[model samples]
Target: MLDAVLLILREVLEAALILSLLLALSQKLHLQFRWSLIAVTIGTIGSWLLAHYAYEIADAMDGTGQELLNAALYSVVILSVIALGLFICPLAFKSHLENNLTQKKIFASPSGKKLIYRLCIVIVSFSLAREASEIWIYLSAFTHDTEMLSSALIGSAIGAGIGMSLGASTYYAFTFMQKSYFIPVFLAIITLLAGGLSMQIAKQLMQIGWLDSATPLWDSTFLVDEHSWVGELLYALIGYDSRPAPIQGIFYLLTITPVVSACAWHAWQLRVKTHE
Candidate 1:
């Protein structure tokens, strides 16, 4: 039960943290939660359906189907975060959509609203599906074992309760900070999270022989092993891999470089507008 609770808590908090950040964003954008609600519903159904076909999924892609699917989900999350962060940044706005190519053209135009709405849907649904599927897979594994049926059910319930409680606490904490006017800081954290998730995708790709990674650059396991509880929490939250492969580092930098450049470009455009 303890193991179950910890496992569920870790995964739930990961997905919940993303949701909390998005919820804070809805307030900033004056958007309704209707789409988010829909996302959750769809995500719940989708995860259950996927869980139903767990065997095929696990065996697909040369036994790396799950990794591939997770990579795709993480990609969606990373892209959505980047899109959402553009809106979160106060200076991101379009100026006639003709003045400059480097200007913030995403959330500042007519189609921007629709884009944001689509992004919100993906953000919520994909996040929920990614985390929920893992829990379902774990819990489902024991269903066929008659002796472990009772234990599995009880553990799942207890785990879910603890996970939800912790998730709620995390949401409230982020909300408090957002209300206190720390939105930029929050966006920065999200940028890192997105980059980290992208790195995880790179790792998954390598796992399936799609990406070639040379070797480990260095090992920090002695300092912070990735198997430890704190390591797992950090992994879920920020993609903190202690013994990161060289490709992971390269990919993480590659992902963040453009995002940072875009932020800089937007800042420059904002300055140019102010001067004019």
Candidate 2:
């Protein structure tokens, strides 16, 4: 239940952040409100469709095929999280490119009437791919459990609602009170989540034997059951495993520490640039 909630929350939060950035950019650029709304609507629909399809595909697989599918899905999730850590985390601190692109599309359109449609499709496709990919991974993780599936979906809806509300509030606060003040904090949180997700993916993949070199660096199985509250909380937030294999531990540290350090450096650079 907790894992389901965390997965949904993280994915929904990321989507909300992306959409909010796009919407805020549109307002900043003085773009048409209708066009922005259309874009967001299309993006949301596309993401939903893609997520449905991914769930269907997972549902169809069984036996060894299901295991293989799960393994592949997790591997993709890990890589995607790593990519976000390396690229998107830094980009979030910078100006909004989606808004810039929308502005360009609007200006370049021969007929202003068609600009909204074109912009909507483009933005929808872009955001949908990222959002759906994350959703697919989360769904794949719990494909075998009907109760967990329902719980995750409910959690995702709730998380999305919370995220949308927060996003709206953030936009208002930034626009009215302190311009760009929240970007650093937002970037930091995203970086940490991405790092943690990547670590979790690595650990999961190692468990499935998709990766080589397995030996526990330290076994804390005696300390706590993984399903216990303390264990589960650490697992959800920090990707902590009490009995992690040596290679898993190494991969976790290797993937998380550098990404975090890099994000910190990026945040510092953004701060300096803002001041200058």
Best by TM-score: 1
Candidate 1: segments with Cα more than 4 A from true spot: 90-111, 178-180, 269-276
RMSD of 1: 4.4
Q: State the C-alpha lDDT per candidate.
A: 0.74, 0.55
**Total residue pair clashes for candidate 2:** 1
Query: lDDT tens string, model 1, 22-83?
Result: 76666555567677788889788877877888789889978998889889888888888887
Task: Write down the lDDT that model 2 would get.
Answer: 0.55
Which ten-residue region of model 2 has the weakest summed lDDT? Answer: 61-70
Candidate 2 C-alpha RMSD relative to the actual structure: 8.5
- Per-residue CA lDDT of candidate 2, range 7-109, in tens? 5555555555545654554454455556556656666665555566665654563423333544444445445444434543444455666434544554566
